[model samples]
Every structure is written in C-alpha cells, then in structure tokens.
Target: MIEVKDVWKKYKIYQDKPVSFKERFLYKRKGVFQEKWVLQGISLSIEKGKMIGLIGRNGSGKSTLLKMMTKILQPDKGELKIIGRVSSLLELGAGFHMDFTGRENIFMNASLFGLSRKEINSKLQEIIRFAELDTFIDNPVRTYSSGMFMRLAFSIAIHVEPDILLIDEILAVGDNAFQKKCISKIEEFKEKGKTIVFVSHDNGIMERLCDELYWIHESKLVKKGKPEEVIRDYLDFLSGSEEQRLKNEVMQQENQQTSQIEVTEQNEEVNKKENKRWGNGAVEITNIAIRNPDNENKFIFTREQRLEVELTYKTTNLKVERPVFGVGIFKMDGTNCYGTNTYIDKVELEISEHGKVRYCIESLNLVQGDYYVDVACHHEDGTPYDYITKAANFSVHSKENDQGIAFLPHKWFFEKGGES
Candidate 1:
C-alpha cells in the first residue's frame, strides 16, 4: 500500500552551473535562478496488489514521481507512506558501481533490497541465467553494453521478490527476446499479487497489464480511471495538440508566401469528423473511404469480410516520384493492429496531379471491436507528404466472442495411446 498526501516537488533551474568553489562563491548571490514545480499538491492512495500505470508526455514528472516512490527523491512538501519493501528499475545502471564486476554488483544491488548473502547465493545462478550474462558475470560492469547492464539490473530487481515494484520505462532498453522475457516475469509478479507501478509509453502493454491508469499533464494528475477510458482521453488530447501545432505552422507559411502559393481551405465539419491530418503540403489527401467488397462505402464489417480503403489525393508539386501509400488499423484504445505501405508491398506510384489509391484487405480477421484507420502518402525513404491519424472509424462484428483483438485459425486435436 502507498499513500501520498499533498505532495509537491520543485527544482531550482540556474542559468549557469558553477564548476569551481570560487565560481560558486561568486555566483551564489549573482546567479539568476528560477523555481519550477514538477509536481503540484498531488494526492493519491494506491491499494495493495494493484497494477497502476502512469501515462504522460515527456517532462511531465512521471519519472520524478517514480523516484519519490522509490525514495530516491523526496517531495519538497508532502507525506509518503509505503508499507512494504520496494524494488525499482528506474534507470540503466542506476544502482551499479561501474568499477565493480557484474557478479559483485549483483550481490551489492540485491543486498540493497535487504537480501542476505545466503539468500543472494541461492538466487545468483537464476539471475545470471535470466540475464544471459554468464560469460560477463565476472567482468567489470563498465565494460558491459547498455543492454547487458539493463539485463543484469532487471534480473536482480525482479528476482528480489519485493512487495512493491516500480518500473520507469527501462524495459525498452533490451532486445525483443529479452523484453518478452522481462514482460513474462512481470506478469508472473502480477499473478503473485505484487503491487506494481509502471510508467511506459507503450499503450498496448499498459492496456493489457494495468488495472488502473493515471494520466499526468503539466505536472498535474489529469485523470485516473479504467485503462481503456483513460488511454482514449489521453490520445484525444495528444491529437488535439498536434492539430493545433500543424495549424499554427500552416498559418505561418501562408503569411510568408501569400502570393506565391494558393492554399485550399479545409471544411471544418470534415476536419472534425476525420482524424487529425498534417503533412509537408507537397501532396494533400482530399478524401478517404472504407468500403466493403461491393465497393460501397461503409464503416462496419465482420470477421473475414473483405474490406477496402480508398485514398484520394492531389499533388501540389509538379511531380512526386515513387509516392508510397500507407494504411494502418488501430484498436479504439490506441493499440496498433496492423500497418503496411506500398513500398513494403512492392507497389509504387508517381503522381503529378489527382490520383486515387485503393488498398483491399481480402479477409478481416479482427475480432469484434471499434477500430480506426490511418492513411498516409510518403516517400520510399519515409518522408511524409501527407499523414493522417485515425482517418476513418469502423467496427468489426463477430458472431463468436473473443478476448483479444485478433482471431486466428486453429484446430484442437487429441491423441490417445494404448499400452504396447
């Protein structure tokens, strides 16, 4: 259990950091400083055995809050009471001594979690095996790569079996296989009713793993609720912010080149209905449609039903060569289902004026859910000419209910053997 009461944290920002004692003494009175509040009167109570997620943009104080929970940093004004032992994977090589051998640091870090030498010895081999660091165990940790260091730190932290676990996006460090292993280990911890506080930008992981989600913005708690609801709101907020930024950029460009170029006015109603759109303006997507196999535009489909996406656009440049068209499907809760581009599929287009591109999905295997589509036109090298997020919305209907987003074809068979 964790209880935070009216927590407030602030840091002093200095124009220049003093490097020497004389400089510090001289600048002590002359230095210009500004105080910025990273967290403002935050109050929350987390029940034991709950998996909580912290979601926010960068510099929103998510990591700062995690550090306070781990007792690495203290809030300037507040009370925090944590009832159980805690283990954190806050940063790569955070608790490591660079000069110490990997084997030695493992023991040292485990001891910080209150593990005795005997207990550490029993778990040492397992930790090494999990980190896949048998050969580098005796080598100085300073010689280890970022991935190797993360492996060792994560292995020790998870194996310690603390009552509470705090993770701050450090899982993004390793290779895919190791990341999977770490996720499995975290799931195991969750099954054992361990309290977990995770901060990650991976929406799918948060939606799948978290029992509750917290949205932080501008060093304040914006919302806290179910993962689906909170993540949807957070995504809308991001989309709105992106659209405003694009609008500002377009206005600035128009002001600078009013006579040289003509800009098409976008319909307000269409912009509101469609997903957020932005690009370099070399080409613009004029229309998008989600149609069924009959070529009729629709926003609903069923599992294994043929679906098609039609994209219409006009190029402002004289000629655009090898224009790659892309489409993506995402779950309503911000999980990316699938994405592909013309380049990847070996299709290319050259457009100097108006053109239409169609992408047909032979069979939609997605389960019953609301899904959104994204369309984009870009170069083969990934430079976007026009990009749209959630350009269209549709729903998939399925007679059979399934737990996950996708349904795969499979059959179950059993075998019986008689005594020989």
Candidate 2:
C-alpha cells in the first residue's frame, strides 16, 4: 500500500556544464540555470493487492514517481508513505558492479534488499536458472551481453520476494522466450495477490495486465480509473496530438504536383535536423498522398476500405540504378503493423527525373486506431537516397468492439454449437 499527497519534485537545468575548475568557478557565479518542476502536487493511492499502471508521455514524471515510491528519491514537498517490502526494476544495473561475477552480484544485490546471506543462497540457483546464465554465472558481468546483464538483474530483483513490485518497462529484456517467461512470472505474482505498479507504453500489455490505470500529464495527475476508461481518454488525447503533428507532415504545394503525384511538401533539411528524415538529396520524396480507391484524399477510413499510398519522388542522379521503394505502417505506440519494399517483391525500376510510385492495401484490417506511414527511397545495396519516417498519418475505425492491433479476416463456422 502507498499514499502520495501533494508530492512535488523538480530538476535543475544548467545552461553550461563546466569541464574544468576555472570554468566551473567562472560559471558558478553567473549560474544561468533554470528549475524545471517535473512533478507538481501529484497525489494518488496504490491499494494493496491491485496492479496499477502509470501512463504518460516520456518525461511526464512516471518514472520519477515510481522511484519516489521505492524511496530512491524523496519529494521536495508533501507527504508520501509506503508499507511493504519493495522491489523495483528501475535502473536495473544500478547496484551491479561491472567487475563482479554474476553469481557474486546476485548475493550482493539481494543483500541490498535486506536479505541475509543464507536467504540469498536459497534463491541463488533459482535466480541463475531463471537468468539462463547457467554456465556463465561465474563470469564477470562486464563480459556479458547487454541482454544477459538485464536478465541477471531482473531475475535477482524479482526473486527478492517483495510485497510490492514497482516495474518500469523492464519486460522487454532478452530474447522473445525470455520476455514471455518474464511475463508469465509476473502473472504468477499477480495470482498470488502481490501489489504491482507497472509503467509501459505498450497499451496492449497494460490493458491486459493492469487492474487500474493512472494518466500522468504535464507534471500532474490527469486521470485515474479503470484501465479501459483511462486508456481511451489517453489514446484520444494522443490522436489529437497526432492530428496536430500530421498537419506538419501533410502540406500543400502547387496544384501541378498534386495532379502529378499528390505529394506533400517537405523541407528535407529541417526533417533531417529533427531526425524524422535523412538522406542525400540525390533522390527525394517530394510529397506523399493517401487516398481511397475513388482518389479521394482522406485520413480516416474503415477497416474494409482500400488504403492507397502514392509517393512522388525526384532523382537528380542521372543513372540511379537498382532503386528500391518502401512503405511501412506503424501504430501510434511505435509498433510496426506492416512494411514492405519493392526490392523484396523483385520489382525493377526505370525512372526519369521525376515519377510516382503507388502501393495499395486492399483492406487495412486495422482496428480503430491511429497509424503512421514511412516512405523510403534507397539503392539495392541499402544506401538511402531519401528516407522519410512517419511521413504520413492516418486512422482506421471499426464498428466491431474487438481489441488489439488488427482485425483478423475470418469467420465463425458454428452450426448451432454442433460438431462438424
């Protein structure tokens, strides 16, 4: 159980970081720094035996609050209390020594959780087996792969038998098998009525796992309620933000380009600076257009509607050979729904200075949600000529109340509950 009342936390942003003593002395007096309040008057209660989630945009203070619950941080204002043996997946390698062997660090890390040496010895083999570092348990952690280190850390933390677990996106550890194993372990813990505070951007996982959800926004608690209700509000807010962002990705140029390719205007240099797009201007994605089969430009469509993506590109390279055109669709949460390239399809290309390429999806089959498109122009050897990411955004709506990323095309063959 936990209680947070009017808790506030702030961080200082220094304009200049001095490297030497003289520079430090010179800048200390001027002190051109600003205080950014990461959390302001946040109050929430985590009831025992409930799995709660904290959802927010990055840097909205979800992790900060989790750390506060673990007592790794103390709020600058207000009262916070927790009554339980706490375990956290935050900063997985914080207490780990690079030079120590994995088996040795297990004892050290577990002891930090107030476990006696004898108690740790009992869980030692279980931790090593779960980490799958059987033969390498005695190897120095510094020599382990990143995934191996994360596996060791996660295995140790979860084995501490804490009454309350505060996890911050550590489920994405190791290979797919390990990740599934970790999720199963967490579910097992849930079955035993252990309190859990989980934070992740994977809406699918959060919806399935959390009993309650809290939305943290702009250093404040925006909403907290059932996972379905709060996540709907959160997704709606994200869609609106994406709408504003799409305006920048979709721009109008002269009608001639629209007639020829229906492309959106872009400043490649600006996009490069923002890391949204980057490539040599030898070949460029002049613009992009998403429309229905009727050639009507639209951003919202149903799962059954045909989605057509047309890309207009120009190449200054007189003989750009073996060109590959690619398009990818991504969920709002950064999950890749689908992607393909002409190279994979073995499509040969012969282009003049400018031309158009179009890819069509007969049925998007995506359940109601916002998705983004990425377009790229590259050589056969994978040298990018023009690679634009999140170049376009669109939404799919459905009458069916099914959850998940996509709607599987199928049918129910039930003959009055009789066997075939």
Candidate 3:
C-alpha cells in the first residue's frame, strides 16, 4: 500500500547559463529565473492488492509523482508512506552502470534492491535467461542496444519480487515479443496480490491491466475512477477544442491581408506533404482522402455525419496475399482516439497492380477538434509494406456540446422513490 497527501514539488527554471566564472559572478544577482510548480497538493492512495494506472499529458508531473513514490524525489510539502519493498523502472538504463558488464550490473542492481549475494546467485540464471543475453552477458552494457538494455533492466527488476512495482513507459523500448513476456510477468505478479502502478499512453493495455485509473491534468488530480471513465476524460482534454478555436481566430485575422493569407495556405500544403512515410516498398500508398456522405473528399466534417477513409495504393509484386490495411485516428496532441484494421474486422484483400480501399463509418461521433489519420499496408506478420503517419488531416465540428472524443448511444432516465 502507498499513501500520499498534500504533495507539492517546485523547481526553478534558469533563463541563462553563465559561460565563465567572471560572468557567473557578475550575473549572480541579475540573472533571470522563474519558479515552476510541477505538482500541487496532490493526494492519492493505492490499496495493497489493486493495480492503478496513471494518465496525463507530457510534462504534466506524471513522472514527478512517480519519482516521489519511488523515493527518488522528495515532496516539497506533504506526507508520504509506503508499506512494502519497492522496485521501479522509471527510465531507460536508469540504474545500470555504463562501464560495468551486463553480468556484473545484474548483481549490482539486485544488491541495491536489498538482496544478498547468495540470493542473487540463486536467481542469476533465471534473470539472464529471461533477458536472452547469454551471448553478451560479459560485454560492457555500453555496447548493448536499447532493446538489450531494457531487457536486462526489466529482467532484474521483476526477479527481485518486490511488494510494489512501479513502471513508466520503458516497456516501449523492447520488441513485440519481449513486451509480451513482460506483460505476462506482470499478470503473474497481479495474481500474487502485489501492488502495481503503471504509466502508459496505450489505452487498450491500461484498460486491460489496471483495476482503476487516475487522470492528472496540469499537475492536479483531475479524476480517479474506472479506466473507461478516466480515459475518456483525458482524451477530451487532448482534443484541444478550445486551443484550436484560438488558432482559427488568429488565422482569420491574418487572412485579412492577401499576402499573409497566401503564405498560410502554402504552409498548410507543405505540412500536409511532410507527413512521415516509411515501409519496405513491397506496397506503396499513393494517396489518402477523407470523404463525406456526398462522396466528396474534404478535410472537415460535422459530428455524427457519415465519414469515409479512402486509401490508394500499388503493389510491387504480381499478387500480394492478405495485405492488411489499417487506419488510426489521433488527436493533434498524440492521443490515439481509435484504430482498426481490415484483418481485425474479418475482411480479406488480395491486391495486384493497383487498388483503392475505403472504410465507411455510419457516424463520425467525434467531438470538436483537429485530428490526423494514419494509414498503413502490412503483411500478416506485422512487417510494414507501406506505413504513413499523419497521412491526412481533418477537423470535426459539432452542434452538440459533448465532452469526449466519441458520442455514445445512450439515454437518461430517473426513478422516484417513496417511503414505505
């Protein structure tokens, strides 16, 4: 179990760096600086056997709170208590010594976790095997790749079997297989009634693993409840409807001048063409378009309107069997709203030469915001044939004042009760 109350953290941001001792002395009194509070009166409690997930925007003090929980950082003013042994995986290669060999670092890290030499020896082989680093165990860790480093670090962390496990986003570094292995280990820990606090942007994984969710915004605790409810609220904030309105107002003012108007349009076109693209070239996506009910390609739509995504591609080979076509809708701030693939939907396609595929939605159901679409064609084995990031940009406007990315089909009902 872990408990925190009235936690506050603050840091000073320096405006300038002195280049020399003389400059430092001269500017000591005049240097500009500002105080930034990363956390303010934050309070939460995690029960002994429950898994909790943390969600927040980048730089919103999620990591700061995690560090405080792990005792790496002290709260400026608060009471904190933890009732168990703790293990933390905060950053990539955080606890390992760069100069030490992978073999040596395992022992060092385990020792820091409060294990004796005999205990380390008993679990040493299991850790190495889980990491799959037998070939490079004796090599200095500096020579290892990011995936190798994460594997070793994660392996050692779990083998220690602490009462509390705190994980950040470090799992993203490893490959798909290793990530699955790590998840399985976490599930095992949960069965053993260990407390886990995880921070991740992958909503699907969090919803599956966590018993509850905490939503943090701008260093304040926004909500704490079920995963679906908290995640929905977080996504709404990331959609940035108010922020986008301000931007549109600024653009309208600039459009009063013909010269400035043309420059803005040119920049928009450049941005559209600059979307990131990568693939093995087995198949290439030529174009992507968003269409409305009238089948007219457009970049904007209304909420609850019929929407379509069209993908145009070409296959290099004579016949490409079972090509997976996928689309992802993401808020401009990098929150994934929804994603789907033809394979997952039980649709099959075999393309030869050139082809066009379209996905139709009965109702867009998206709230008012700017969003980007990602399109990809890949093999069944997850090898990308052609993957495009932010391939198309679009905006959704709504007459209804909804608070989330999607509109659910629901109705409100009330019941009256009388004393018997």
Clashing pairs in 3: none
Q: Can you give the TM-score per candidate against the true fold?
A: 0.66, 0.69, 0.65
**What's the lDDT for residue 404 in model 2?**
85
All models: lDDT?
0.87, 0.86, 0.86
User: lDDT by residue for model 2 over 82-134, one digit each (tens)?
Assistant: 99899888875778999999999999999999999999999999999999999
Give the candidate number with the greatest TM-score: 2
Please say which candidate is ahead in lDDT: 1 or 3.
Answer: 1
After superposition, the stretches of candidate 3 with alpha carbons farther than 4 Å from their true spots are: 17-23, 29-31, 241-392, 395-420
- The numbered model that scores best in lDDT is 1
**Residue pairs in collision within model 2:** 263-287, 263-288, 264-287, 264-288
Candidate 3: tens digits of C-alpha lDDT, residues 63-114: 9999999999998899899999999999999989999999999999999999
> Global CA lDDT of candidate 2, please?
0.86
Question: Least lDDT summed over 10 consecutive residues: which range in candidate 2?
Answer: 255-264
Candidate 3 Cα RMSD (Å): 13.8
